[model samples]
Target: MMLGSSNAAVDHPTSNVTAFIRRANSIMRQLSSATLHKFVVKFPLLRGDADHLDRWVSLSAASRARRIVLDLCPEVEKFGDKNQMYSFPLHLFTGGSCVGGNPCVKSLYLGFVSLNLLPLAAGGSTTTSGFTNLKQLTLHKVSIVGDLQSLLPECAVLEWLSLTYCSLHCHDLIIRQPLEQLRYLRVLQCRLQKLQLQAPNLTEFEFTNQQVPLVLGDCINMSMASVELLLLSDDFDYICTKLPVALPHVRDRLTVGTAIRTEALVLTKAGAVFANLRHLILNVTIHGCPQASTGVLRLAYLLDLAPVLEELELHMYCVSAPGFPRNPRDLDAMATSPPARLHERLRIVHMTGFHGSRGQLELAHRILWSTAALDRLIMIIGPRIKVDYYFRNLTFADTGRLVARRYIQDQFPGTVITVL
Candidate 1:
């Protein structure tokens, strides 16, 4: 059962919201009392009364909805304003049995809601149980009050948990209890000083935030992980050196992203290795293009660490990068340097947001020249040079393709190259 505006992108008037609530009330009253497998109510611009919102949740609970999604569309303007968001009535689920007790909900997705769990009692312990059958939980743009750790013990069966753009009252988010069945965890754009989790069965983890101390205790089964850190200090070395140690068990796929002002790439610790790593993606944003060549060439050091890596993807973002230079001296010097040794195993290389700068071309040239096992090189032209930043002689893609055709096309006839 899905209600409210299907298109959350469009804003709705107050009268329409009020009418929607009235219509939803009528439908619920008219329907035959039965179980609901799924109940979804999405309204991006809804500011309904608390009583009306509580009624919807109560109806869903009474119907025994297995999956409930209450997405109030938390728009950009509602950010950081917890009072403006609706407070979810979690006490309705703190019961004993199914008939008059808790709803057997397996998945709960809440957006733009304030979730205030029960606080800790004396001696720092509390035993309020809710979401007992919840296997997956996703909270987006939500406000969390009290300690989050106090509420997780009740959710003993939670397998997947994702928190995006959520505000937690506490600075330290420490989940000491072992989530025995948790398989996946994702935390994005959440402000926290420290994060510590004990999920023994967790296989995949994704975290997006500024670099902070993280303790993923007993996560030996983690096979894939993506960590994107906003480089406030513009230090790329920290991402290269410290992250490998932090997430040591990442076996198959690994993605590391960072924004850097300085173009100097330094991998201090060469001992770190992704022994089982196959696919690697590097999402890098450079401040400028002139110094990009230096940092770009240094990526060879990182490639040396991933011995078994087969596929590599590069997403470069440099909007202010200048057009192709008349004389690319940096390209000539970089071309002579020996390629990253892992190129033999690297069969496919995909690049997105490519501006066809000298640095980008040089990297492409070096890879094509050295890698005999290379199968395909695909470069997707970016809109960086298309923007009227300055007077340009050619379009963004044209410049990149021209540079590639002039330098690389004739030399690398064996490999399949696609420039779009």
Candidate 2:
């Protein structure tokens, strides 16, 4: 069951929240004791509509709804305080009055609501009655009050948990107990100072926010992890040394994204290795000529860490600014030591924003020379028009294509070269 006005419906001439609520109430009355497998409610709710909101929640709960999505967010996200937003009645479901004493709510998505877990009794002291059967829960723009740690244990069987845009005020989220069933976890835009969780069965994890200390204790089953944060050149050392320890057991893939910086970049620790990692993706932005070559060359250190990696992808953004070199070729210099042919297991290498610059060429040559098992080299020849305002050689796209077809094809006879 789905009821509510979307952003597009809000602009329609016939859209009326009052009439819509009345119609929804009438339809809900017809549902009576019918079980609801999925229930979705979306509308711009105001303080005056408290009764209607309560009735909706009560009806959904009573109907044994398995999946519920409440998106009664204001059109403009300018709620003055938590009191002005709807306070979700979590106690009713926890007390077992709702859903005929069987809390069947398996998946819940709450938006623009306030969640206060204090009223649900101390965590695991009373009972894991509320949210015990919940496998997935996502909160968007929800004001979360009280300790989230207390609430997690109640959802013992949770497999997927996501928190986005929730106001937590730099809360240190620590999960003392293990979540054995959890397989996926994602947190975005929540002001968090630190995250330390132990989800033994977790296979996928993603976090996007300010730099914070992350500790995922022994995620033995973890296969994919993504960490995107605001980073400066000084943070390079921290990323190299700390990230491996944070998500220690990532086996299949890892992706890291950082802000555009021109300072000298390097991986200080080369001892740590992602022995089981097959694919590695890097997204970075480089300032023109002066630092571009040195900055990008330093990425070889990453390849050195992922020795058995089969696929490599680089999303390089080259930005043009004042003091940019007039000739990119002048900035290119050979590494002090000759390039080593170490990546015997590497097979595929794909690159985007290939400007045919000196730095790009060096990296490409290094990969081709090292990866004896390479089967395909795909390079997307282009520039970010918005960022690359004044390239020294605007015809770098043509240059990139020419080099890929001739140089790479001639050097690596068996490998397929694709230039776009």
Candidate 3:
């Protein structure tokens, strides 16, 4: 009832506020404010107007709104960090019973607003059972410390929760109960030290954290999970090393589809490998490896870990990072023997930024010859610049990409090869 017309619904919350308030008053007189619910107050350019905003929150609380969304910005286009954000009076969110009023909002969404959890009751919303009955909660660009620890327990039925670009200060982010109905959770770039989840029936989860330890205690019904590492460019060591020369250098006519024979590779030190992982998308910086040629060698180690991997995508990039340019063939000369055994499960292979470097070609040769059921081999050519700039060798001049394309074309004449 607070939002007047259908066209002027949630979207136009603050366009001519006085007129809308008048219309809302008329609606309240007819239908009664007790029945008024589900209002959104999104004011982008409402500068120097805290009195009106505070009063509106008080009124919405009085109506005991079921769903409320508040989006405010001092300036129309600036974000929380760019411009001064409008702070919502958290005291106004208390239930009508708490402050001798009746705002019982069920679903609350606050964006570009500050909630000062300190100097307030522990868990911030203790004054009222205001957020207890909520089913969904979403906060964007909100800075909070210990507030979440105290608040989430009250929302017994909270199902879906998403925190994006929220500045959270804590050592351990524990999520347990009152959130029994919590099924979906997405935490992106929160910069927490650790995240511990105990939602038993949690079905779907997507977490993107660089520096946090994630522990899912009892997500029994979890069917799908995606954990993306925040790959940041760092100083890489680009020591020069001997390119991997295939032992059975030439493709044999008799054993064309067999595992390519090579020297034993001193595998890179092993880490936790996903056994159930079927598909892998990897982004590798060219200079990240100890040497340029070993970039492919590094990938071979990854393949060894995931035996059931069906689809593999490797994307390569380099930001022209400075490196420790030195000669170290022995360290590079890991006795890398392309697995003599063929991985039948490995089917599809796609490599992006394919410049047909010798090391990369060696990798392609191994996969083409080692893989038994390969259905498609795709190569994507990367940005073109002067060849002499990176390497002085004329062998890899303009033919870098051309050579990669031709190699795949020649090797996989029967299989589908896509070149982009």
Off by over 4 Å in 1: 7-12, 30-33, 44-48, 74-81, 100-103, 122-125, 231-235, 289-292, 323-344, 352-356, 365-396, 405-420
Please give, for residues 231-341, the per-residue lDDT of candidate 3 as tens digits: 452211110110001001111110000011122234435434345456655555454332355444445554555567677766554333322224334324434354677
Residue 260 lDDT in candidate 1: 61
Clashes of 3: 12
Between the candidate structures 1 and 2, which one is better when assessed by TM-score? 2
Cα-based lDDT at residue 107, candidate 2: 98
Per-candidate TM-scores read: 0.81, 0.84, 0.67
lDDT of 1 at 359: 67
- Model 2 lDDT tens row, 1-420: 999776534454235776788888998889877888999998767556779888888888888889999986776545435567788887667737453566788999998888876633544453335777889999988888876776787778999999987887438777777888999999988888898888989999988877788987788888998887754433455556677777767878898876444446544774556767788887765653433565566666666777778788877666643133456444333342345546667777777766655566667777776665555544333333222224443445665565555555555566676666
Better of 1 and 3 by lDDT: 1
State, as a TM-score between 0 and 1, how close model 3 is to the true structure.
0.67
